[model samples]
Target: MHLYTPHMLLAFLLLCLAGAAFPCSAAPADDGSVLYSTDFTNAEGWITNSKDRFYPEIETGRYHYLLEGGTGGYSAYTLPQKVNGQFTLEFDVTPEKTDDGSSFRFGIGTDKKDSQRGPLLMVELANKKDGRLFYLKTVSKENSLNLVGSSPSTGSSGATVRFEDNTTYHVKLTYYAADSRASIVVQQQGSPDVIFTASAPVSGKIEDLTNLYLTAIGDGTSGPQAEGYIDNIKLTLSPTHAAGDEKDAKNNKGADETPAPVITSAPATPTDEPTPVFTPGPTRTPFPLPPTPTPTQTPKSGLGFLVLLPALAGGAILAMRKYP
Candidate 1:
């Protein structure tokens, strides 16, 4: 008796292969002196002290936040050391809803608990948009959304970013303490296209950069609920600034005096190249990351391999069997 036809077997094999495939967790610039990091594996270091419903919570290895009614809370984490010197921050964040409210802010400051009340250097996922895309600008005592808003050049995509809803974006924000400058690069997970990028001087002395804060707030009035999730948090302090950058910092101080560096904007289309790495400077030179441990990625030789073996066997048997 005839069994399955060649076409049927081919379809089955394809389905099996599809079942075996999966996405890899996104990789940021991995090499550095990791001062602090977390995948939200638990709630040990973070504190969420907002009112009952509008506060952030730890769940499923992610920091999830829901905001509405113009109110919100923070995901605060005390750091091992104060944030200073040249450093880089990398993480995975998804803004589920920013259609309403002012914006969501995150970064380092002296405030152990209240970051917004201190000398903060943060990246603001602003509610303001350039055309259809929202602005990704840096904010501190000096760089406010109002100042950045004057036809803000592009606080644009690092390259090409749709900044779509409910999609995770891996971000790298590098700070050059020497010049008080911050540059940001963001890309959707599993891809290497920098959808949003900006390099602007932090503009003033950001002192006592002590704690880490991800304070996601919402519009004061009820509207579209603003929500977000962050994962794979990493903070790296480059023991020192890039070589000879202190002098450069002095030379570049005038940059702040000139028309403030507009948080230029644009969307970068996805590319097959590896993820782009940013050094704390204007050159945008490449920095090779140190080798990553093998544990992070899902292994290919696990259960999927075992299951695919049957598909391979079934395909071979059906292909060679007589159909008469």
Candidate 2:
């Protein structure tokens, strides 16, 4: 018959302690520190182009970007300082009018001292030949216009959210500079839990520099121009870099002289609302999340083993003396 040994009991106790100290798996944290947030109460930080066609206004307690039967509109704002590593851009958008030829774009990158061109990574919401679609693009480091709108073909598989007139959506874009990758998620307010999600590799340098652009464009000969209401624009950064860092301070040098451009536009005026209609596109269903399992209490068998060790040792010593 085999006898219980002290070493065998010690091994079992160590194993149990190890399991408790280090779990096999855990989910990543989803929260981040807010670096910038705005309700659009005023256009204090934004810089609109000198051209009236691209200018936006703060009306009815929201930042309004309206393009009425025009080619394109452009508005941009430079960050107070450059950012690197991981950052997230989130905002709420209410589409007033969008059609087959309408395009709404948001871009981020380093803007040159005096030139409008720079390395940009952009997210485009538009109706493509395939149907109403959302896509991503990057202006290559070559600074060539030919490669400005070239979008990568591959992305995460999921239904695209088709925006109806006056329907609001919460959009989030997260970029990881370490891997040169980006992900986009859109959720319609008060409706679906999640509208759609897509991830793709981003091109260009993706420097942690200071420049963001909002663009609305039309095909000129197509349907009505694009118009959208934007609010609650926020920016978040990882906790590691939430505070100012050496790299950020280095980029801030000489930023005062050519700080964000001064934006001058016409007075605030409310535009007529567009008629509502059903937009034909993909039927988006919220992705199902994995069910969380309830944690069960760990067995206390290890403690029982330890208690038996002392008694067993005493018995074994006696048995050996009697046998000898």
Clash count for each candidate, listed in order shown: 25, 0
Give lDDT: candidate 2, residue 172.
75
Q: Could you tell me the C-alpha RMSD of candidate 2 in Å?
A: 14.0
Q: Rate residue 30 of model 1 by lDDT.
A: 33
lDDT of each: 0.56, 0.54
Q: Model 2, residue 221: what's the lDDT?
A: 47
Which digits, one per residue and each the tens of the lDDT, describe model 1 over residues 1-324? Answer: 457776677678776666667534455443348898888777577676664533335445677766444445666788887766777788887887776444556777655434234356565555543422433344454434212321224432233233556788787777766666666666679866544455566645655577787664423455645577778888887654554654444354323223334543332342455433322344432222322334345445467677777868776676857442
Candidate 2 whole-model C-alpha lDDT, 0 to 1: 0.54
Off by over 4 Å in 2: 1-32, 50-59, 67-72, 112-118, 140-156, 216-224, 239-324
| Native-referenced Cα lDDT, model 1 | 0.56
Report the number of backbone clashes for model 1: 25
